[model samples]
Target: MSSRASLKANLQLFVTRRCQLRCRYCPILKGDSLMPLATALKGADLLLGHQSGRVRLDFGGGEPLMNFEVVREASAYAARRAKALGKDLGFYMVTNAVLLDDAVLEWAAKRGVLLEFSMDGAREDHNRYKSAYDRGLDPYAATRAGVERALRAGSPHFVIVVASPSNVRRLAENFEHLYEIGVRRFDLSYAIGGVWSADEEKSFFSQVELVLTRHARELDCGAVQLGNARQRLEPTVLNSELMVDPDGSLHQMSEWMFETTPPTGEAPFHVGTLDTVKDINSLRWSRFHSYYTLVRLYDGRPDVRAALLNNISFGLRVGRFFRASGARLGKVPA
Candidate 1:
C-alpha cells in the first residue's frame, strides 16, 4: 500500500435519503433510510485519517437537514477531530431550502456550514419541477422564505440552478431573478438524463454563454462572483470525490450507484465499507489511480475535454457510443 497522500480532498456523506419535496429529476432514492450516527462518525473518522491537508466534508441527501441531528453531530465531531489532529476542515451541505428555519440557519452559521440551495429558476419554474410531498404545500414559497431567512441570519450560502430540457430556455431569466433576490454565487448544473435535441442544445449553450458573460462582466467591476466560474477558472485537479452512502459503503462516484450495467472491464468502483477497511489510504489510492488514468487519457485531448466540460448530453452520447463499440469488439470470436 502506498503511504503517499490520496488525491481525494473531499468526502460527501449521504446522510439521509428522506426528503420533503418530490423533484421530478432527483436521483436520490427517497425513503426513510438515514445513516446511523455511528456510521456517519466512522466515515468521518476514516476520511480524516486517510486524507491529508485541508478536507471538505459535504453533507448531502434527498435533503440532509431531514436528519439534522446526524449532520450537526457529525460536523461537530469532525471539527474537533480535525482540530486535534491539526487539519483544516470545511463543512458543506446541499438542501432544497424548503426545510430551513431560524434555528437551522443559526446552527449552520455558527458551525460555518456552506449551505447550497436548489432552485430551478423563478416561481413558476421552481414549482413546476420541485413540489412538496404534500400537494397542499407550496414548495416555491417555502424555499423563497427559507432563502430570505438565511439572508437575514447572515448565513453563508449559494443557489444551484438545475437546467432540464423543459426549463433550459428560461435559464437566463431564472439566473437574473436569483441575482435580483441577492444570490451572488450560483451553480448551473444541467440535467444529464433528459433528451436534448440539437436546437435545445444550441439554445442551452447560447443562454449559458450569455448569462456567464454577463456575470463575468459583473465580476470584473467588483459586482458579484460566480462560484462555478471561479471553480472552473481555478487550477484544480479532478481529485477523488468519494461518496459514503447511507449504508456506510464507500463508492468512487455517486453516479456509479445508478449505473445499470456493471463496470466489467473497469477498475472496481466499490472499495470497502467503513467497518471493514483496515487501510483506507490504499482504497483512496486505488480510486485516485483509476480516475487519474482517465484524466491523463483525456485531459490533453482538446476535443474530448471540451465535449466533456461544455455539454453533458454530448459527453454521454460519445461515452455510450464508444462503450458499445468496445463491447461489440470483445465479442468478435477471434
Candidate 2:
C-alpha cells in the first residue's frame, strides 16, 4: 500500500439510527440508539488527525435531524480542530427533510452545513414509497414544504432521487417537477440487489436518456448533479470514505450497514474503532485503498473503470440476495 500522507478522506458519521419516516427502501428501519456526543467528537478527531488535505465530513443516519444538537456541536468542534491543524473541512447532512423547518434551515444556513434531502420525484411517486409511520402523515407534502422553506431561507440544499422499478418510468417527469418547484440541484441513484426485468431495464435507460436530454443545459451549466451518470462518465479513484457508526466503529462507506458481518465472508469490515485507533492502517483498509489507487492509474480509460464498478455492483447484489435468503431460511450463522 502507498503512503496516505497526502490523501484526503471523507468521513460519514452515522449520528443516530432514529428516524421518523418509514421509507420502504431504507435499509435501517428504526432504532432509539444515538451516537454519544463524545463519540461523535472523537470520530471527527480521528478523521482530521489522519487526513492531510480538505476533509469532507458528512452527518448521516436513519435521519440526522433526530440528533441535530450533536451534529451542531460536533461540526463546531471539527471546524475548530481543522483550523488548528491547518486542514480544510466541509460539513454536510443527509436527511429525509420531513422534519426540516424554518428554524432548522436557518441553523444549518448560519453554520454553512450543506443539506441533502432524500426525495423521490413528485408528490405522487414520492408518496408511493416514503411516508411517516402514522400512515396519515404526508411525507411528500412535508418534504415539499421543507424545500420551499429552505429556498425561502436562501440556504444551500440539494435533492437525492432514488430510482427504483416503480419510479424508473417517471424519472424525467420527476426531474421536471422538481425543477418546476425550484430545486436546481439533484443527485440521482438507483436501487441495488434487485433483478430488473428486460422491459424494466429498457425503461430505466430510456428514462435516464430522457432526463439527460431534457436537462442537458442544466447539466452542462453545473446546475444539476447526477451521481450515477457522473460515476459512469467520469470515474475517479475511490478515495477512503470512512463511515463511523453510532457505536464509534469505523467502516468503509460502501460497508457502512454491514459492519458486523460483511457479505464477502472474508473478514469483518471492522477496520478499527474510533476510540482506540489513532491511525487507520488495517489490512482491509490498505487493500481497498491500493485497489482504488490502481483504478485511478487507469484514469484515461473510463471503460475500465465502468466495467470495474459494474462488476462490483453485481457482486454486491448477489451477496445481498444470498444473505437475505439465508436469513429467511434460518441458515444465517449466529
Candidate 3:
C-alpha cells in the first residue's frame, strides 16, 4: 500500500500501561490499568466494522504482552469480526518479548499476526537501556529466548534496534550481531526524545550508511529488508499513527513521543474515542500541535512545557534526518 493508504488504514489500540521494563528512552504513559476486554472488543469492532476495508491494528502499550489475556482474546475477536464481514485484518503487536509466552506465540502464528520484537541490537546495549526494573533479570536473555522461539516457530517477526546517544555509534555493530542471529528484518530506530547533539546525529547517519552498505553486500545471499529505508514520505496528520489509550481516549501518535514519562502532565491531541467517534474519516485534523500550542495549553507548568519542547526538537531532528535522506516520511516500511 502507498504511504497515504497506510496512514489512512492504521489504528494503535493500547492494551495496558503496565510494562516490565523501565527503559531509559521510553516516554509512554505508565499505569496498571489494562484496556478492559469490553473496550478492546468494542474498539476492534468499531475499527474493523468501518467501511475503510482492510484494518491494520497495532496493539500499543507498556509491553502489550504484560496484558496477555486482553491481547489474546481481543485479537481473536478482531479476526473473527473481519472474517465474518469478509474483510482483511492485519494484526500486529509490538512487544519487548519478555512476557511473550507459548500461547501468544501460538496465537500469532495461527492468526498471522506480525510480531514486532524489541531487541536493541547488541546484548550489552539492550540490557543496558532496555533493562527490566528488576535489576537481576536480564531483559536481553528473555528477548533472545522469545526471538529464537519465534524464529523456530516460523513466526513473522522483525527486530527494532533503537539508535540512541547511548548506543548510536554501536548501531552498525549491533546490526551485525542481530543479522548473525537470523534477524533478516530490521527497524534501525532512532530514539525520539530530547537531547540529541550534533555529534550524535552525525554518528547516527554514518552508522546507518554502514548498515545499509552491509545490507547491499549481503543481497546475493538473501533479502534482508531494512524496514525504514523502504518507505514513501508524505504530508500526513493522524492517519499514520492514532493511539487509543486504555481509557478509550484517542490521541495522535505525537502526544506520547517523550522520554521516560509524559511531560505534559496530561496527553495532548485527544481527537476522539470509540464511544463517540463512529467515523474516523470525519475527525478534524490539522497542525494542532506545536510549540505555540504547548505554550498556550501549558501556561502553568514550565517544567512540563520545557520537556514537551525538547520532545518537539528531538522529533524535528529525526524528521530532518529522514527528509535529507529522502526516506519517504520516515516510516518503518509500510
Against the hidden reference, what TM-scores do the models get?
0.78, 0.77, 0.84
Q: Roughly what TM-score does model 3 have, to 2 decimal places?
A: 0.84
lDDT of 2 by residue, 252-329 (tens): 554322222123333333467886678643323443653454354445546444544653554344334333432122
Local distance difference test scores for all models: 0.69, 0.67, 0.71
Per-residue lDDT tens digits for candidate 1, residues 1-334, read: 3567355667899898888898876645677899999999998898787557788889997689888899989988999999999988888899888889877987797788888898877889998889789878899888888887887787888788877777888899998998888877676656643345777766766776677567665655545544543323111122346778899987665333223222223443447788886555566454345444434444545543443344444534433433443322121111
Candidate 1 global Cα RMSD: 10.5
Candidate 1 TM-score, C-alpha based = 0.78
Task: List ranges where model 3 is wrong by over 4 Å.
Answer: 1-7, 219-222, 232-240, 259-269, 284-334
In model 1, where is the ten-residue run with the lowest total lDDT? 325-334
Candidate 2, overall lDDT? Answer: 0.67
Maximum-TM-score candidate: 3
Order of candidate numbers by TM-score, starting with the best? 3, 1, 2
Which prediction has more favorable TM-score, 1 or 2? 1
